[model samples]
Target: MKNARTFTTFALIALASTATALPFDAIDATQAYQNEVAILEATGAMPSTEPVAIFPAMPEEEVAAPVIASLQDVSLPAQPRVGAPAAVGVATQGREVAAPSADIALPAVDLAALAETHDALAVRKGEDGEADAMMMLSDVLFSFGDDRLEPAAVALLEDLAPELEGATALQIAGHTDAIGDEASNQELGLRRANAVRDWLIANSALSADVVTATGIGEVDPVADNLRADGSDNPEGRALNRRVEFLLPDAG
Candidate 1:
C-alpha cells in the first residue's frame, strides 16, 4: 500500500506504490532540516564532519538561524510552514529506499505478507537496504492528536498478532501534519506512537523490547500543500499522517 498525506491541508489517498501520478511537493522541508548540519559544514560555520552535541540547543538555535537563512538565496524549497495538523504519515514512490543509504532507513518487505499478515501497511526498501513499512492510522484510530488507540485500532491489532509474534523486532514511526509548532508536533507524534505501542503490548503477545517508535511531525509529505483541500486531490493529508514500521538491524 502507498501512504501519503498533506498536513498543510487534510486529505488522503491510497495507492500500491510510488506512482508517476503522485501530486506532491517537489522538495520536502524535512529533508532540508535533516541535512542542515551538512549544509553548515559546507559553508564553514561548523567544523568538518563534527556533529554538534545539542541539536536545536539554545545556542545552536541562534547559530542555525544564519545557516538556514543562507538557503534562501538558493533555488531549493526549504521553507517550513508551521501550525498545521500535529500528526501525519509518510509517502514513498514506487521504488524502495535502501536502508544503508542514509541516517534514516525504511526497508522493503514482502508486500503480500505485510498486507495480509499485518496491519494495513505499505512496505518499501530503503536506500540502505533496510526493510521498511508504513501504516496509515486514521483519525478514527485515535482521537485527533491523542496517542491512545481506539476500539477500531484494537480490532486491527487483533489482525496484527501473527506478524508481530514472528518478527525479531519492529520499529514504529509517528508523523504529524504541518499544523502546529514543529517542536510540539514532534512530541505529540511521539506520544501517539507510544500510545499505540502500549495498546499492542497490553492486548497482544508482542514484547516491549522488540519495538522502537519514532515521531516525525510534518516533515515528510507525499501530498503538496497547494491543493490540500482535496478539491483536486483524493487522499490529501491523511495519507501523510501515519506510522511507519521497519525491520531492525541484527548487525
Candidate 2:
C-alpha cells in the first residue's frame, strides 16, 4: 500500500511538470512526460511552489487608434464676376481708337416707316386738288450711267404687275442727277420713262394709250446733290436719278 501511494504521487508531479514545460499544442506529449519523469527521478522531488510564467503567446490581431490629418492655410487672388466691364485698347487702321461708352444712347430709326412717309408726301395732285398714290424707283435699279433697264428693274416691273391689275390710267415720269447737262438729261429721262411705260404695257394688263411717259430732268430732288463742302453727293445723286409712277386722280 505504501509503494503504490508513492508511485501515484510521482506520476501526478511528472504530469504537472510536463504540462508547464510543454504547451497545450505540443506535438509529442508522451515524450515531454518522459523527459519530466527522468528529471523527477534524478532530482528525487521538485519544490511545491506556484508555477512560473513561461513563453508568452501572441494574439491573432492588433488594434491601433485612428489619426486625422490637419489642413494648411492658403491665399488666392480675386476673380472677376460675369457682365463686368473690362477695358481693352483696340488698334484700327494704324490708329488707336477709344471704345464707345456703354452708357451712351443712340437715336432709334425705322427705315421702312420713313420711306413710306417720303413717298406719301411726293404724291401728284390733280387740278381739283385731289391726289393719287405714287411710287419712286431708284435709278440704281437700271444700268449704270444709261437709260436701258437692268434685269432687276425688269423684275421690279414684273412684281408691280399685280398692283396694276385694276388701274385704267397710269403716268410714268423720270428724273436725273445734277451731274449731267439739262438738255441731255431731259432726253435720257424721257427715254427711261418711255422704256418703263412700254414694259408695263407689254408684260402687265395696262393699255399703251392709258400710260403717258414724261421727263422732269433734275428739276425735283429728294436729296441734296452736293454735300456741305460742295462735294458731289453720291447718295443724293442716286436718289435723284429715279423713275416716278403716278396714278392720276379721277376727273
Candidate 3:
C-alpha cells in the first residue's frame, strides 16, 4: 500500500512538471514566430508562455484581448501574405491580372453598412448620383511600400470580419501610382492582386468562387489629378495608387 501511494505521487509530480508554460522573452525569434503562428492559428494571439516550444493552447479571452489592443491604431490588414513583389515581398502572381466576368452572380457585401462609422474605409460613391457602397482598400488592406498584410491586419479583419462574412463574393483589385513604367506597374499590380486573392482564400472564411483578383495598374483614379496638399505633380498620379472592393454587381 505504501509503495503504491509513493509511486502515484511521483508520477503525478513528473507529469505536472512536463506541462510547464513557455517563457516569452527567452524564446528565440525563429522559434517565437513558429510559436506565434501556431498560437494565432490556435489561440488567435501571439506571445505565449510555454517552455521549450509552445503548443497552440490559449484561452479565448487571452486571444481576443490582445486583438482589441493591437488593432486600435493600425487601419490596414494583417501582414501575413497579401501584396508586394513576388520574389521578395508577399506572394504575388506575375503580370496579367485576371478579373471575374461582369455577369458572374457573386455574393453581395454591404460596403456602406459595414463601414458605418468605421474610418478604415474609403468607399467611392456611385459615378452617377446615387447612394452606393463599395469596398475601399485605401491603405487599409496592405502595408506602405509593401504588399503584404500588416501584422495586426488579422485583428483588423476580425473587427471587419462581419462585413466580410456578409459578402458572398469579393473582388480584389490592385492599383499603382503612375511613377513607375507601365510594364512594371502592370507586373506589380498583378502581383499585389494575386497576393490578396491568395490571402483571402487561405485566411478568409469565404468561398473562392465568390472571390476574384485583378490588377488595373494606373488605369483607375479616385482623387483629383494630384495629392491633397499642394503638389502639382502628385494629383491624379497619387490618386491612381488604390484598390477597390466591388459588391456583387449583376452587370
Candidate 4:
C-alpha cells in the first residue's frame, strides 16, 4: 500500500512536467479538458476545474478620415434666361435711337426776289400756300349786277399792268353784294372774274397759264350788307362788290 501511494505521486509529477514543456497553442482545449477530467476521476479528487468567462475582441480604429470643405469656398458662374437683361458684372455700351419719319412733308417758301421786287403791291398772307392781294371794284367799273366791263374797268386794269408784269401765279376772285339772288349773283361774279383774268392775260405781260378766275358771290363779306334794322347799307354793299388776286411763291 505504501508502494502504491509512491507510484501515484510519481505519475502526477511526470504529467505536470510534460504539461509545462508543451506549448498552449499546440494543444486542443477540448482534449486537454477531457484529459484533466479523466485524471481527476481516476485520482478521485474532491473538486473539478471551474468555468472561465470569454469576451469578443475590440474593433480596430480607422487609419485616416476624409475632410469636407465649407459652402463659401465653392464658386459657380451665373446663367441668364432668353430675352432677359444682362447678368451682373457685364457692361453695355449704349441703346439704339429711332430715325425721323419719311411721310412728313416740309412747308413751301417763296423767293426773296419776289418779295423785294413787289413791295409796292399789297400782300395778304393766307393759311393755304402762297400770298394774296385784293382789289376793290367801283360802281362805274361794271353796270350794276352786269358782268360787262365799262371804260373805267379798262383804265384800272391798265394801271395795274406794270406791277404784275413778271408774276408767276395770279388768281382773280370776284365777289358780289346780297342784293341779287344767290345763283344769279354767283354766275355774274364768275363772268366778271373771267373777263378780268382774260383781259390781264391778253392785254398785259402776265402768262395765261399762271392766271385763274373764281367767283365767291356774297359768301365772304368784309362789311355788313344790311343795317341792324334790315335796311339797305349802300356803302357796305359797294365794299362787298370787289375782285381779289393771289400770287403764289416763286421758289
Best model number under lDDT: 4
TM-score of each: 0.47, 0.47, 0.47, 0.47
lDDT ranking, best first: 4, 2, 3, 1
Clashes of each: 49, 0, 21, 0
Q: What is the model-wide C-alpha lDDT for candidate 2?
A: 0.64
Whole-model lDDT per candidate: 0.57, 0.64, 0.58, 0.64
Instruction: Pick the winner on lDDT between candidates 1 and 2.
Output: 2
What is the per-residue lDDT of model 4 for residues 183-207, given as tens digits with 9 covering 90 to 100?
8887877888898888998998777
Runs in model 4 lying further than 4 Å from the true structure: 1-132
What tens-digit string does per-residue lDDT give for candidate 1 at 79-114? 434953233223367554433322333342343366
Q: What is the lDDT of residue 170 in candidate 3?
A: 70
* Residue-level error in angstroms, candidate 4, position 28: 99
Q: Could you tell me which 10 consecutive residues in candidate 1 have the lowest summed lDDT?
A: 7-16
